[model samples]
Target: MYTCAACNEHYCRRGELEKTPSNCPCNETEEVEKFKELYLQEENYKLSYNSALVEAEGYCKKTRLEEIMDFANKCDFKKLGIAFCVGLNQEAKKLAQILKENGFEVCSIICKNGSIPKEFLNIKEHQKVRPGNFEAICNPIGQAMFLNNEKTDLNIILGLCVGHDSLFIKYSEAPVTVFAVKDRVLAHNPLGALYLSDSYYKDKLHKK
Candidate 1:
């Protein structure tokens, strides 16, 4: 079991294992060597190098949108794709506009674009948010296919639901990044849970 989170001495920063706990992954020499080999690959090296540059350039200085634009610029990506939940259509539209203004060719797809019925997934009537109503399932695959057809260079997730975002990322051919995550009760700011973990949401998050 990995217990780095419970460790107090983070000796990995100095590339030293002297103070690493017994269970630390750093102690697993074979696995660490394999992971390093992966980063040595040409494509992997470029991806990681550019990601590091983006992080360093934008650290605590630039907004997320600005950072994304900077990163895309660095990667020379001309076309961008957005997969957004239906509930966040307005925000998606605004994001598309911003990307366009930033000189990117934007392709935006809504989660319910294909109009696939929830019944096709064998979901029971009671499973629907509103029973007896015609509900459309979120088609993350369709969103990815549409963007793939458009040959988008990078895909941005606006506010896809939890599992839906995973499906979208799985199906997307291009590199993916998340701009926002859907949190209906928290206005799409999921970190509110962490921010209040010590007080407001403590009992709910740590149930006895």
Candidate 2:
């Protein structure tokens, strides 16, 4: 059994630990700090970032919106990319409009851009979650390739399905930010599972 010092909870498995920092009283601060210094200080690629740390330090007196605008101004990032699922098309269009209004050149790609069938990949017909006899294969690679061709400075994801999102991120040349994650039951809010875990998701904890 693993005993959590901060929470005083005895858990059976080491791998089943909760991510909450208070759950781990035995601090690994030195190891974490050493890794951070190596990655953030020593890496040449890490030095090139105009990251959230710069925006948060009162170097710019703006809110997040204003800070993003300031960063965009400083970087002169003329082209932006949006990679979205077909289910979230309306939201994506609205978001694209907003980005354009904020003086960005936007290129948007839908997940079903090529409209290939899922069954062609040997997916069972009955196993289809959204069974309409017409299922479109999520083409995350295509979206990334399209955006890469457009030479976007940044790419944003809106409501991409779990594995598809990973593929999109893997293939994207530009930096990626998630606007929404796909969680149909909880309305795109994945944290709802964490919050309501005791009541609605107790099975998740018991599976191990």
Cα displacement (Å) at residue 202, model 2: 2.2
What lDDT tens digits, residue by residue, belong to model 2 across residues 84-181?
A: 99889999998889889988999999999888898878888887876668887899999999999999987888999999999999999987777789
Single out the weakest 10-residue window by summed lDDT for candidate 2. Answer: 42-51
| Cα-based lDDT for every prediction | 0.92, 0.77
TM-score of each: 0.93, 0.72
Q: Please give, for residues 1-208, the per-residue lDDT of candidate 1 as tens digits.
A: 9987887878897877877888988899999899999999976786788889999988999999998898888888899999999898889989999999989999999999879999999999999999999999999999999999999999999999999999999999999999999899999889999999889999999876
The C-alpha local distance difference test score for the whole of candidate 1 amounts to 0.92
| Residue 99 local lDDT, model 1 | 94
On lDDT, the leading prediction is 1
